[model samples]
Target: MADRRARIVLVTLSDSFSSTIEAMAQDAALAIDRWTPEGDQSWPDATAAVWLLAGGEETAALDLLAELPTNGASVFVIGSSTDHRVAAALLKGGASDYFALPGDADVVRRTLDRLVQQEGERQAADSFADAERGSVGFASVIGESAAIRRVVEQAKRVARHDNVTILIEGETGTGKEVLARAIHYHGPRAAGPFVEVNCTAIPDNLIESELFGHERGSFTGAIAAKQGLFELAHGGTLLLDEIGHLPIELQAKLLRALETREIRRVGGTKTRAVDVRVMAATHVRLAQAVARGEFREDLFYRLNVVSLRVPPLRDREGDVELLAGRFVSDLATRHGLPTPALSPEVLSALRGHPWPGNVRELRNAIERALVLSPPGTLELEQLWLERDDIPAGDRAHSLLPFPAPLENIIRAAVAAMVELTRGNKSEAARMLGISRPRLQRWLSEDTNEPTDQ
Candidate 1:
């Protein structure tokens, strides 16, 4: 499969232009499929497509661009129009590149060659990564509950189709990325890159450049041309983690790139085409955000085309003990300690407690217990279980009036959760029952607040 010849699809209404492109493709030793506008046509198995726009055929070209199945295939448009606006419109509509008719065949050939070479390199890199990671199937997901099984089955079905956009919604630490990776490794584009970008981690000033690449000297600090996550994810999947945190301004640009299958780098005049599947994961309900005007309604519709919600830990009945046992064994092995058996009482406690932080919290708790316990059967005392076992006296003392503002108390609690989770912000946010962004804002405000003299 790696040695298979690259294929090209040529769409044209002009016989002369068709002859010219066919000649160029033939000279380049590439397989080509030629189609005309007079009939309905399906793209043959091709790595790239070239659409020739004829005079007074802008509508037809735009229609074809909209109708063409991207499926990680690059599509370019060629026309005789010198109007910069026309070219811009075509590129924004979905054309990878818009070249004037009687354009340099050498440049087209060179571009095609580059695309093929880059694909080959990508395949080689994917092969290496796959080998290192092994196979990521539905089984890798750790849960036997019906809800989880149903999600896995749906993911398997969707993985069979390569071009569908997927939106995954869940509470933090519900394994959204794990599910995304499972889909990618099992899909048609499994032999490509799987790039991930966290929306909340990047600053607003740099988000665009981080997503769409930047030209050398594009900004004050950019000294060299850099490829963005979208371009690097070419021929594979791009996981936009916490996409609900994306800024409103950048959301529009993101929608444009997803709609057009093309992106212009920061300070770049040329719009480059990218072939990548986008999978977005968010804890925030985007529909509500759309109503609130925090998220774009059009982008919401686009991303919500196919949505999957991951079930929280509490919702997966009887899975807690199973997951806890697995975590204990895995952590014990990693730490070179003997696996401890959970007492029936401990199992009961585990089953009763609601895991607000989901799998991550459970994993961390088990790891913490193992590190502190000696070689023996684990007792309830070894695990730091959150229980309602506080004595009446301690509970009464807890109500003592503290000389601190409500904001100060909240700031202290947030800091404590952060510390308890060992700097795991996502888990801290989940345990605090607040969004990560809100938690961050609270912490930021606390840091910036004036200290008492």
Candidate 2:
């Protein structure tokens, strides 16, 4: 019974049900094993995929069922047309399902089909509280704010329970991927591979085959069988980056895979078991998407077991100076340039500016500044920060996407002015030729951030 294949053993005299199953097995090339009931017939090694019991004699069936341990280790289906009392007894004695023969044969067939497609999930229930870590770990997540520190501590706590799914939420450049890597390397699955798939980057038509693989000749271009990112990540982690962009059609399949720990090849007839810790990272607000009818609610709850939000760079108080210094030193060293000092004025400017793109943009700014500055000196002039940093009159036209709604253009202008003035609405209004009350009205109307007021 521990044979690890989809096989059903029967203890019934229903020729119709057995014949139907036999025909299905032959057509589908499935393994159908029949074991003789022992007067000494011990409980099916009890490791079989399914046990089909028929109450030929109600008393004998009830007695046999009582003697067997029908805990959820196996699926038990009993067909009873005999005593209603006997049927009740079987169900109470751990029979998962009770159905009359032939009429309910379709249900029986469907259950077998699902079993044949995917194996039972075989996850270890033992605790992994003392999981081992890889050589490289969380040291890469550099930050001192309580915002980021709390995220790191939460990650470390869940790292020990490697099988739990995680949802990482943040703005585009807020280091969601970096946090995902930290979770994987610090857990027991450190030695296994770490695979990443950007759901947005893949074409919509090919994403299914890309995530769930395909059999040879399954489609026009599938000349050879290929394993998907999920299978490639077996025994390790699979980070579905930009997960909110995953197609709506595939959302249900994804939910089933997560729940069952199994997946089927694109054109294959059977399902296969997989052991991969899944992590979904998204910058999009999935709840809003669900409201828009673009994402599935069930799938959202499935992946939301542990949510960790990475704070935007603007929110992490003193991290800008530290991060900029580290980036400058590291980038300079990597490019073989002398390490330059960030003067007091330059540091003040760096700290005062808002980093819309978070740490990624900060790193790029430091590298650009290092490359533009003289070998041993860094000045504020050498750091452009970003093109958006230009004043309203100088870069106003460049910010608008045009063809956009008048409100949208106004919104962008207001946001740019706010960033340009470092949240100084008075100065921003003066530059934009708008009154203080008007600026407040514009900020209040911002839908994405009502709290900006």
> Which residue segments of model 1 deviate by more than 4 Å?
1-128, 132-135, 387-412, 418-453
The superposed Cα distance between candidate 2 and the true structure at residue 143, in angstroms, equals: 0.9
Candidate 2 per-residue lDDT over residues 52-165, each given as its tens digit: 556355455556654554333333545557456655565555444455566656655665665565443221101121242332367778889888888999999999888999
Which residue pairs in candidate 2 collide? 38-41, 117-271
User: After best superposition, candidate 1 residue 204: deviation in angstroms?
Assistant: 1.2
Among all windows of 10 consecutive residues in model 1, the one with the lowest summed lDDT is 444-453
The worst-scoring run of ten residues by lDDT in candidate 2 lies at: 121-130
| C-alpha RMSD values across all candidates | 9.4, 14.4
Give the top-scoring candidate (lDDT). Answer: 1
Backbone clashes, each candidate = 1, 2
Best by TM-score: 1
lDDT of 1 at 320: 91
Query: What lDDT, from 0 to 1, does candidate 2 have?
Result: 0.73
